[model samples]
Target: SGRVDPVTAARIGKVLGVDALILSTLTTLNVAEVGGISVGPLTVKGVKAEVIITGRVVDATTAEIKDSFEARGEEIEASIKVSDLQGLSFGTTAFNKSVVGKCIREAVENFARNIISNPDRLMTHQIELRGKVVKIVGSKLIVDIGSRSGVRERMTGKLIRMVEVEELQQYVSVPIGEVQVYSVNPDTCILEVLWAEEAPMEGDYVDLISLK
Candidate 1:
């Protein structure tokens, strides 16, 4: 609501295949030199840096605020030797972004620790996959989910198919089989069949359910 707009929430829901979503926001990520600095022929430059970062967790569907956190970082007062106080045009001293990066990391990690496992946060490791099986090799079931989709070794999935019954007039993707990731590439993953009610044939549906 405050951060995730309707279009963004819809797009994210499509990707996650979930009716709800947990949203994280970076409210503040800023860095500045607090101490005074002497420029151009005056004198020296003082280096006292300050960083502030804030994070907020929200529910995309309910438009509710779940949690919020703040973290701060600072660089102690230091001296930067001036090569040329009165340079012709530009000097070669550049402020480093790493200090601000540290602050952001602290803020984000703190936020994750506080809210990731909370029941109200609605966080899950589940990954939704929608693609057809390409081929099979012995007990191995290879699919189109791979590094790009965050697939890794030892990850598992459930094989399902939408079947229709003339009497019921509805389609369902039942857990016909279970599979484990054996190997993976950038855009492909090889899964080893663990159990199946019936042998899975080519062109079947493969759902790499989750990473955690």
Candidate 2:
């Protein structure tokens, strides 16, 4: 919802049935013009500029901003030439043309490695496909994720097997194993289990994942 305030978040939560939502914002992807002629006699021209990026994560329910991260790239346009525009120098076109491409790539790469690579960082909320393990023969698993859910061969994800908690009268996911899509049809797929804590059985949960 617009602005992500309490009222907006509450409306969203009402429809989605989630108390708190993880929100992420890109605070800055600065692209300031840095090179030109000195506007005033004391002004500097063609100075090197840093490529900077910052991200913030917030809790929607309480409207509280939580974790923040930043990444700064190396100074670009280390060398500069005074504009050739007879006396009146203006835009940074000439300077930016030389380094803007490389600067942006470095900045984004640094940001991802420093900030988004954490295990507990932003996670996808989209549920494309979810199915149950209908059958298992040795290390091979049969799941319901297939062409209907856009699943393809070689795709991989973890199998979350459900375990009934007798004391709590509820069910919880037990990590069954990592699985790879080996074959797919219109309605189902066969998976090859690469690793498992316990042998997967009927009724284990299998959720599809995106490579992106």
Candidate 3:
């Protein structure tokens, strides 16, 4: 029933280099005492609890709360009946264990759902491309990728060589150079080669190296 402290949230956001935070609160907890059975002279008791969780997503950069929602679920447990007289039979112990497990699972699920629904809270993007090298002129290597897939100027990518082995009859790729996009068109870009052992060819695979 406690909100995540602002100081703690800020620290977490700073560590993750993100601009958002999520806060959760437990609103309701219902406990029910289910009937128990007797094995010989000892009587066992069973209890089940249902929990409701609520949360909110906030943008730490702007200090604005983005979204909020509530989730509720009942604890799960398997039914058991006492059978033996002298020894402890299937009874309240099993139900209590199940209820605890269910509560933990539900809490985890609610936390994960809150994270999955908020996209703006997380902002690391990466893409791998397979395209023709097209041409290499002076200090630039032209590849066949564009702004449609988030390729932009100043972004760094890796130029890889895909080689087909004749004896092994398989194709493999190896990193040959790193390049930064200097200019970008609608469907292509000119990359400035930063480091390379061999010049890129007309057809080669490129991979986005710096994701952040």
Best by TM-score: 2
TM-score for each candidate, following the candidate numbering: 0.41, 0.47, 0.43
Name the TM-score of candidate 3: 0.43
CA lDDT of every candidate: 0.61, 0.64, 0.67
- Segments in model 3 whose C-alpha atoms lie over 4 Å from true places: 1-122, 209-212
Count clashing residue pairs in model 1: 0
lDDT for residue 109 in candidate 1, whole number 0-100: 65
Candidate 1: residue pairs that collide: none
Candidate 1 lDDT, tens digit per residue, 152-190? 788777887668877898877877988888988999988
How much lDDT does candidate 1 score?
Answer: 0.61
The clash count of every prediction, one per candidate, is 0, 0, 0
- The list of candidate 1 runs beyond 4 A from truth reads 1-125
Give the deviation of candidate 1 from the true structure as CA RMSD.
11.8
Error of 2 at 70 (Å): 5.0
In model 1, the worst 10-residue window by lDDT is 84-93
